[model samples]
Target chain A: MSASGKIVIALDGMGGDNAPAMVVAGADIARQRYPDATFLLFGDEARLRPMVDKTRWLKTACEIVAAADVVTNDDKPSAALRKRRSSSMGMAIDAVAEGKADCVVSAGNTGALLATATVGLRMLPGVRRPALCSFLPTVRGETAMLDLGANMQCDANNLVEFAVMGSVFAKSVLGIDAPTVGLLNVGAEEGKGNETLRDAAAMLRVEDSPVAFHGFVEGNDIGAGVVDVVVTDGFTGNVALKTIEGTAKLYTGFVRQAFKTSTLAKVGYVLASSAWKKLGQRADPRRYNGGVFLGLNGVCVKSHGGTDALGFANALGVAVDLVKYHFSDKVVEELNRLRQALGEVPAAAAGGVAGAG
Target chain B: MSASGKIVIALDGMGGDNAPAMVVAGADIARQRYPDATFLLFGDEARLRPMVDKTRWLKTACEIVAAADVVTNDDKPSAALRKRRSSSMGMAIDAVAEGKADCVVSAGNTGALLATATVGLRMLPGVRRPALCSFLPTVRGETAMLDLGANMQCDANNLVEFAVMGSVFAKSVLGIDAPTVGLLNVGAEEGKGNETLRDAAAMLRVEDSPVAFHGFVEGNDIGAGVVDVVVTDGFTGNVALKTIEGTAKLYTGFVRQAFKTSTLAKVGYVLASSAWKKLGQRADPRRYNGGVFLGLNGVCVKSHGGTDALGFANALGVAVDLVKYHFSDKVVEELNRLRQALGEVPAAAAGGVAGAG
Candidate 1:
């Protein structure tokens, strides 16, 4: 938090498909919502300054930090890490680590952002692996899921860590005091999945665990909002997330095709357009653009690269909310409490686990 | 094949939620469509005879085989197998294995059916494990996906086998001459996913492979209809399949809620009722009710346990289609060709690989 009780957000202005234009436009939108907040914009001075100047609100609220290099989405994580000192994405993350900014928001290459943030901010004291957490729409409400694509292959311990992190995220962001957590598996039965999920379920089911463990949940349960937090290995999580997105698009396409089939349907579509628009707004992907990288020492959110100004603004809003809620600190405190209750040493004291690629 | 160029299908009369009644009704519907086909109904004669007598078509075309025991949905696969000789589910499968029926359609416990069928019918030559294959509606059309739940953990060889089997299925059932096969993965990039998927892609991309390999496809591709067949390990496949189903239901629920929000929307829904009905029929779960158990010596289709008569009839239709097309023999032929092209010895000569469970 800054002196005026406002949070400072570091923005990677040169990231995402729209680059400085969307970033500046998004900051302008966010500025209206959070009048007290300021931004440290990192990008090429020549391109970013003009964009910032065009937006009166952004010009007043943002300070441009020049960086000569831009990390393209095609850059590998290792390549991005090698250029951390000079890249806009890297410098933005660095500002968060140095405590100059409360959090960092970037519409950049996901792999690059995760790599740069992990190395720049480092993992929290008791956290083994950081998970990429995001909220997905469900029948009940938005549910938070973790390890979306962070650790493709995870052990029982890693899943346990994710469950804890996801629970904290749901609590702090979704405002669920004691978020219910369900391990994603093939079936709801105890003996359904592989050894790793079974073992993780056992650990989560313990009385003193931080999460309100709801045991195993199948894939359908995710969309049904069976629990507040859904935990799984990154491979399965990533696949499931993408599958939902794909299915949504597929059905929407079907609706469009149906409307075009006849003159009566075309007229009916017009008559029903208002209702359909409301449904579309509720299912908008832009509203759920931000994916927070949990378990890091500082707050870091990755926005969708292809998103527009509205989506980027929503991403900024997420950063603001997390900072205001003291999300990172709360997570650390929860992990420490959990460790003590389980009679286990801090991850740092136990020799910190290797970071996942 | 049965006498007079007809196909024989064995029905488990004691299976499904509304057994005997639904089964008899479903058989009557299927009999009307496939007038030349005959059915061998297995269940307690006392319970099945009356139901069979009530349905005019079923009474004329079906022969009832008495089996006193029933495999409850909660019954373990092992327990179901123990009662193989006495259980209706087992006897129906046995009918296929013993050459009395061309295929078996069951609406019983999935685990029990998979277990009993694998034991009763034995594995097809060169197949390491049986895959639970089914069709899912995609934007372009319907696509066949395999290893939905069987073979939870699969190797490269097993995935290749699934691809071959899925291709044969699409050709025989969906009527695609050169059905393109895509490996279901986390990304379209070659290097994405675990070692098994990578290895499977390598094998699938070989010049002489039976199916037309379309390289890698992401979760979204399943719904996009990017290929005729999608192959993946059972765990991911099952998760993806269920996720799609859950999402479809979620969106439909949203649409329903939206239509009820205002008077205008209600009128619009009424006007658009025809289009909505068409979309509903296209997206009907009943139309895609059956999941065929592939890689076994005999053909067996599993229907949804909770499905009504219409749904059960569709499952029976899937069995009849497969039998009429000689689906089992084609799969075996494709696998044998695939093995020879890869310079691998026949599975039968090498002693067929053990079943997954």
Candidate 2:
């Protein structure tokens, strides 16, 4: 937030596939949604100025900050940090850290964005690590999942913290009251899964813990909306999320193929097009575009690099919502409460929490 | 195969949801497909005799073995092993171990089945553990994946063994020529995943490696059919497989809901019913029912406990195919070749390796 209490968003104009244009256009859409919000467009001014000037209200809404370098998709995170600190993605994160902007939204290389954001903004006071979290649509409603590729492997404390972060996230974003949290495991039984899971489950099961622990949930439980929050180590969570996306595409292709099989089927598809459109709208990947970096000092969102203007705008909306809800403050409070409860159980301390798996 | 060159299969009659009836009926169907394959049905003779008698050809094709006990689904693997040795599920596994049957198919408790099978048939030479494998429908064709919940965590050597085991299974079962292998990891890059993945990849990339290692593959690649075999630690493989199943169900539900919206949709759904039927047939869970326990000394397949008669029969087919192709002997050959290649790399030694993740 700025001195005048207006929400200021830093945009990485050169980040995504259709850069500058997509960034500028997405900002234009977001401007209408949050009229009080201001923007800082960081990229090459020569290219960004024209793109901003062409928008109806973007010229008055945002200012183009000059940045000469970029972090390409193929660039390693370590290399990007060393060589491209002056890149659009880096500058946007810098703006958030320096309080020049309220939060940062970048559609750049995920590893680079994660590294840059964590380094620049720093972790929250008690957070050992920040996890990538996002809400995925389920049959009943949206469910928030965390540690989505931020840490490939995690410990008991890490998972317990994610549950706290994700529970707060679900409550704030999904508007669910006392959201249920489940540990993603191979089975739903109490004795099932690795030592990390068992330890995490023990911690969560304690009375007065921050989250409403729902015990263990399997992969099928994810789509069934079995819990409001699904927490796991990054590698498994990332794989599950990508597998869901790929399976959706595969099944959708099958549906399309089935419709094209015969003349009668084609006619039926045309007559039932509205329902298909509704289904598409309900399950649109674009609507769930942002990957929110939780446990950071400030709001940081990573949009899908290949997303279009609409998707980018949706990512911006996620940042706006987090900022509006004072998500970070709530997370700190929840973490404190969780830690206090965990303190009663000495085994949950970070030093004793390395996973046997 | 028996001394007379006839295939022998042992069936656990009281294992699945439909139990003795489904097992007997499925055997009747299998008898038609393989006239020479004799079944040894292990269960209560009172229940099994009637089911076989009711079937047209099952009475002649199968011999009922009286086993009073049965392993319940709720029994733990360790408990089942201790107390249920005389149980039908146990007797079925025993027959294979004693060479009275060439293979066994059980739709009983999964954990119990895996534990009992491993103890009874034992692991093949050079195999540290047995892996659960199953082929899933992909965009191009089917992709074989392992070890689906056999080992919760895996090291470099465990994964290398799975690659060899999965490669041989794909060639023999899916009939894919010289099946390409992929280590299921968080990313496709060489430096992406944890130490376990890196070590496994290094072993696979060697000059004289037995399997065709196509670098690393992500979760999306499983459905994209990027490789014929995907090898991973049991936890991730199980989660990915179940996620694929969940996503397929979620999308299929969406397709069905779209056709239930209005009068026009209802008419369209009925007219396009054939397409839906065809689509259902293409993605039928029954057709992909069996979960093959690879690296075991004998052919052992686990059918879905909830599956019907047709599904159980499909599992029988998998066991029959493996027996006919001398799967166990071929696995030994492949494992020897893989071990020889890995033997040259001193770092690939099991005692020296453990995953940092």
Candidate 3:
């Protein structure tokens, strides 16, 4: 928690499709919900200053920091890293690195944001790589899934590290005390997936494991909410995440088309509009727009670039929540705890060690 | 196509959750739809004959082929192969290989089914490996995706073979002519996935390609119906398929919960019951039960292990349709065409060649 009783959130005002307008409006919306939060807005001052000035809430709560260059969505991570000193996205992440802000929120290019954050804040000790973690809508409210697209190829150790980080994330952000974690595989069976997954599962099943290791979970288990945190290599995680998003959109489209097929259907749709509205609210992707970069030294939240003001606001809320809960510190502590527990076993016998303890 | 007007479908009477009861009931249902379709039921004749005889439709449409042993769902592919002479699932596939049946349908162990069919029927020339292909519900209609869980690892050539097979399967069963195929990847960009995927995409882009290659598509495109055939390695394909199924179930669960939340919502649901029913029918997992084994010399469809009679019936329909359309022959022709088109260039320069021609 901040000593001043107000959390500082660094905002990349020149990122995303709508850029300044969405950033300004989203900050205002977030400000209303988080009265104890302040913003360090980074972008082209000429464009962002007017937008902030027009917004009554942002005018009072945000301070604009001039950044000449903006990282475009098409910019590769390597290219974005080279422009870190002048890009708005880079400056926003730097605010977190410099401890000027509690967390950074950017509806920017995902690859660029990840690259900037990794180089700016650096990875936490004992963390091999940072994973992109987010809350996905599941049957049991929402479940935290990680490594959405950070490291495409992951070793068993990377997956084990992800399990610890994802567990800490679920607890800190989703407020689950001892979140159950499951390694995403082709089947729930012990030997279902490739060697990497099997090895990761073995590590997670240790007695003193940080997460409540739930053997192995299949893809269907993701939406079933079989576990609080679902861990996977970035390649599989990204595919599953996008597939869920796409499937939801497909179903929604089907419902819309079905309603318009006939007059009776249209009338029925009108009658059930209120109920459907509630369902839509509950399943809205905007409410879960933020993807937190877990295992980083500082809190970094990535909002979807194509999101609207509401989505961006929700992402900002995620950053605020994470900072308030000290997510990064907790993750570091958990990882250290996991390493200590695993280190006790003899190095040569590590592969044969079964339990987390 | 089958020489006779009647398409013979070999039924694995001992497979799936419901087993003999569901198999008999499913055959009766399928018979009602396809009067020309006959079944060769493989299982314990003592148990299956009694069940089949009790049903008027099954009694006339199905013949019992005695097989004492059943392939348990957990049986390894190697173990299943050892029991090829005795297991019901094996016998069912053998019928197809022996040309006693036009096609075979089983709701048995996927790995076992794939292994048995591949060994029994052999892969069509030019196909490096057989792919597990199935219809997935998409916004436009159902799209055929291959390598659902057959080959966990695949090379670029294997992916190209899958693309050809998937395109042929789509045309034969889904009745889509000139079906557009897309290589499944992390991103749609030319530089987006692993080297193998990039290489496959390069091959698919050739000017005279047998299938209509639509370049790369992300996970979301699977449900968006961006292409008629989505091709990928088994690992990614299986994960994506199950993710879609899981997400759909999650949403269905949400709707059920929402409608029960309040009395007014209950009333709204009653009024929209008809529309909701239609939506349910369209999105029913049972309606899309069968997964076709492509690239094999024979037709084999794997149904959901947990599916009921209606679902099993749908699986039977898939096998019948595939046999009627001579799916395997079409796939062989398409692969040959693809190979010939690529063969125009020097053998050493084949991989670097781009465009269908």
| DockQ of predictions, in order shown | 0.67, 0.63, 0.60
**Predicted model with the maximum DockQ:** 1
Give the Cα lDDT of each candidate: 0.89, 0.88, 0.86
Give RMSD to native, each candidate.
Answer: 4.9, 5.8, 4.5
Better of 2 and 3 by lDDT: 2
Q: For model 2, give the interface RMSD.
A: 1.0
lDDT of 2 by residue, A1-357 (tens): 654558999999999888878989999999888888889999999999988888876679898889989889988899778755689999999999998998999999999999888899999877888999998988787889988899998999899989999998887778898999999999998988999999999999987787999999999989888999999999999999988888888899888888788888888888887788878998999999989999989999999988988999899988888887788988887777677676743443523345634
Residues A114-166, candidate 1, lDDT per residue (tens digit)? 99999999998778898899999999999999889988899998888888888
Per residue, candidate 3 scores C-alpha lDDT tens digits across A1-357 of 478779999999989999889989999999999999999999999888778888877789899999989999889999999999999999999998898998899988999999999999999877889999999988777899988989988999999989988888887778898899998878888878799888888777776666788888889999999999999888888889999999988887877776676676677667666778888999988988989998888989999998999999999988887888777777766766666567753433434345755
Best-matching candidate per lDDT: 1
DockQ-best of 1 and 2: 1
lDDT of 2 by residue, B174-230 (tens): 888799999987888889889999999998988777799998998888988899999
What is the per-residue lDDT of model 3 for residues B313-336, given as tens digits with 9 covering 90 to 100?
Answer: 999888887777777767766666
Off by over 4 Å in 2: A2-5, A83-85, A344-357, B3-5, B344-357
Candidate 3 residues lying further than 4 Å off, grouped into runs, are A261-264, A344-357, B344-357
